[model samples]
Target chain A: MAWFGRHGDGAEHRPRGRGREPQRVERVGLDDLTPDPIAVLGQAAYLQLGHFEALSRAASTAPTLEAKGSLSAAAGKVLAKHSAIIAELDSRGADSSAAMSVHTAAIDRYFEMVQGADWYEDLASIYFTSGLLDDFFGRITGNLDGGAKISASISSDAGSEDIVQLLADGMSKDPRLASRLAVWGRRLVGDTLLMARSALPHPVNPPAGEARIEPVLTELMADHTRRMDRLGLTA
Target chain B: MAWFGRHGDGAEHRPRGRGREPQRVERVGLDDLTPDPIAVLGQAAYLQLGHFEALSRAASTAPTLEAKGSLSAAAGKVLAKHSAIIAELDSRGADSSAAMSVHTAAIDRYFEMVQGADWYEDLASIYFTSGLLDDFFGRITGNLDGGAKISASISSDAGSEDIVQLLADGMSKDPRLASRLAVWGRRLVGDTLLMARSALPHPVNPPAGEARIEPVLTELMADHTRRMDRLGLTA
Candidate 1:
């Protein structure tokens, strides 16, 4: 289920720096190497929409007003980000609807595969699954420009930190829940990886002139591992 | 299940006019006559939160992206309004959490009673249920001043027109849906009235110095009938 193309032999190494500088690369323009901006943005919108749905569901199922409030706030942020992406797409004269349609089936299928049974599981899914996706977007969009950057930035900061904290707080109160959530986290990541590979566009030919997605995947996994450790889970 | 107090004998009639002018009345101040602003605003927030839940649910169930987008937009607006109401309560030194707790059971019960089965029903629920509530708020708050006015005004314009149009469009496409929705609309109003009467703070004693709530109920029902007419539903 690997979606990334392998780098060709003798690919140039680029210096790594921080603060939004496009990563240095060899053999292709970063724009050409990256996935189509429309597709990326469209997939982003679909994902945010999914987050909105999940948060709303969690809010309804939440046993307490405080939990419902927290979930509602998270959902609101997702909606705002989704709206910003749509506006960015509109400004670029891109057909957001068409782009969204392209990945809707895969995104919907992923959600169907990972429906949570309770509020805690829902929160776990958001904290782990969405956290990884946000980090992944941040990494992949590092080399993009213009509307792609704007759209990606809109989604890259999904405000899941609050949800993560909430989940952590919940687990802290009931340490036994941590073990169950650790298992849930594993399932979430497994389903996420499967979905990503199946849903995201894949490079057909050898990685020359195409963005090497392997490094991005590796970075995402490393971040996910750190997040799991923070949540008292084995990655 | 009636929550309103009776009007004092021989209370002078105030002339009705448009635009923010406080209505004229004899013997009682509007603020004294109205429900506590904090309570009203709190209930409004709860209702808006419910709308957010319903809209998000509808968006997920919607068959098309266009429908999902519309529902998302509506949810976003409700969130913004709820935030504004919360801020207003905060500025007034009212405890929003405490206020919200006062009506949580009633609001939850209302939702439990009027749960929508599908997207169209959800849309109708938003249109008829929320629309009537907004009108009732507007009528009751006509005499309120300052923060009370601002808070009520925030809730009074729930932006349900778009949802109403969505429902009307859906009904136009399938006329048979109208009869079903007409019945649904009746159930919505009945449940709403039952909830309102049960949840709202009632004046324990009869009419002396109490603002007349019967007139306001009559007015709300009349306006609701007009809205029903607009939707081509029999009141």
Candidate 2:
């Protein structure tokens, strides 16, 4: 593995370490690091500001009653697909791991929130709607499919029935139609981008200002660019 | 099982189903049924207002340094716990369901936003903290655990592993802790109650003044009371 060291100004460089493998070094303080903190903070702040604003706007302006209904239907379809996979996994008597647990925990949180007292108009309509876009984006951008693999790994049998597997099965019945879903997915992403742009320039950025997230923002931009190139889309 | 039904107004009762058996309704509409919209709306509005206000307060007055550390530690611990469970489940070869799949989709959305925006602000913190609450509520509420007892019908272990069996094995390592956990289940309920009071109210209420959750709230309260009494906590 290639290891880079931080120079005096925080720029990455080839640093000599003990033998072939480098002994890890820790920078004690922010000042001790070499990168410009202000620039880093600014980039981070802008990204968050943009994202939160986008989410707020997208959620707020969702198509209202029909939006919830349509989204719910899509959710149900998705669930059916996943349930089939889970049942198969159960039948196979396979093993699970930390990653599966993370997925489970993430899912558990979503369901609980949806069923909670606080689940409201905005979330049902906007948060979820825009969120669907983000989901598709991550999937397409990441260029992978694990739904089938996850399904095959677990038991969808009586012992381990999962909603995701159910949805996946349902979707597979008319898998070709799954491509039609791209229209809705595109709309969701568009809304999210709009919201992000609107929310980016607020007077006070949340969590921390831009400085806290510069590295992350930089990475995201790079990823976005890569994704765009892969998809033959203009960045 | 007991069934309750009413006309447009709260006072009128209509018996539409079978004479002895409780009727199973597929779904209930919130807006059309409520007699007093203002009260319901007020509750929703209150929740939204509180969440935003909390976000603001956290942004201005909360200790950023401590929050940063605690949030990271708490998230890590939560992730670790979930990972271990997933690992155990995977080892047994279980598949998740369609409902779980939908839930996972929602979770993936939140995760993307958090990671993409690298939000350290109040928004990210709120999402992270509240996610734990979701997990707690989901487990106790029977959403994930209560789907179906179809697993009991399985005659063979052709493609299945028993999660309970896995749990039992781990518990065998610390038999004393198992009993303690069973007993301490009451404390989890108590702690859940405390956290509910502190954090749940935010999501409960929203901006639109459309509080579409009185029945669920009442049911939750009643269930919690029953559990408390069963635990012999009643004075």
Candidate 3:
């Protein structure tokens, strides 16, 4: 759904005195200040989910005792920063049992596998990197324009033209692989939509007063379609 | 335990020209290069457990479509990488069921929390960062001379120095909060050690094979102790 390069502080060139929140630069939820609240909300939900994936993987597999300790400390800091999002979602009174159960089962299996004598380094690298990519993608997917803007910001030195070319080259080298990945990507979309539907069916309280979700949802869908078109993904 | 300043990478710079398998730049499992087979076994077991955690989280929580679609892809990658270690450990015919069950439960709990609104973002950041740190610590803990090397390296970089300062400052500014986080860190360590103890009572086999494990473990333990000393913690 989204794409962007990593955001290092010195890399962004957003002119001095822009007065934009610096934290927002590294971890921007959406790229633009679009007026469509629905699309913005959808995008927010999606990106939050993506970031969650990144955070969890990063914290759980710390290799050395020292590194693990440092990361645990980082985790505490990150949690403090993002507590608002959690509280907002919780205020919604969503039903998260099914998703939580499935997620937990998978982690258990991983713990079992790695704890065994069969673990290896190369596989560890692959698992770790690929997971990282997924999490980043989740963060930027809802609004392609915003994602592109952020991606450009992240790789301000090379910018989107270069990054997109890199992606294109990578994809071109393995067209079959890209196709396979696309199919998989579609499946994830489906799964996410299903989850969203599940969340919707529950009569959760709005973070603000009034359960005025449908209008917001409609606007979000429109923005998603707009983003898909921008990314040349919509047929 | 160790910190990497900008200068650290320069000192031990080994150009990857040809005919060198990275020269064991890291001291992994053993206390010394002289070798002590028993400790190697323990370290190897610990590494595998780390792998399992990475794989499970990547498979379940990775937001990317490709990563999520064929969970087997991640599984296959892990199996291939750890095949040797797996074989080595299996050869021992030890009972891993109890430990496996415990890990599975922990992972399950983690994933469940992730799926819920209560702790999604916090959990996500923790997971991904933890994976990166694991790789970093595993590789760097032993290549240096002593605690001075580690302190110099840790103090050299701005980011790491900031992190160290941030932790120290935070702990000092709010003792109650710092105590809570310290308690959390201790619990995580205890849980991990318990899992390792339960999973493999013996060596789990390193990628380098049985002959190489004891030395690696010895090195790892020494490095770990040094790092703990630097962090002002009891490991």
TM-score of each: 0.84, 0.22, 0.28
A76-182 per-residue lDDT for model 3 (tens digits): 22222223233333444532222233334433343333221211121221222223322332333333433443322221221213222333444566565444433
Per-residue lDDT of candidate 2, residues B1-235 (tens digit): 0111222321212244434322321113222322222222222222222222223223223233233222322322222323333332343344312112323333334333323111222332333223333333332222213211211111112110221222244356656544543444333343334443332233322431123233333444465445334323331
For candidate 2, lDDT tens digit of each residue in A1-235?
0001222212222144323322232232122222322222222222222222222232223333222222333322222323333333344453212112323333323333322122222232223332332332222212212333432221112111221233234346656423433332233343434322222232143333333233333443454344333323334
The regions of model 3 sitting more than 4 angstroms off are A1-167, A175-191, A201-214, B1-235
Best by TM-score: 1
- Clash pairs detected, candidate 1: none
Every candidate's lDDT: 0.68, 0.29, 0.33
Q: How does model 2 score by TM-score? A: 0.22
Q: Model 2's DockQ?
A: 0.02
iRMSD per model? Answer: 0.8, 13.5, 11.4
**On a 0 to 1 DockQ scale, where is model 3?**
0.08
Ranked by TM-score from best down, the candidates are 1, 3, 2
Q: Which candidate, 1 or 2, would have the higher TM-score against the true structure? A: 1
Better of 1 and 3 by TM-score: 1
Error of 3 at A20 (Å): 37
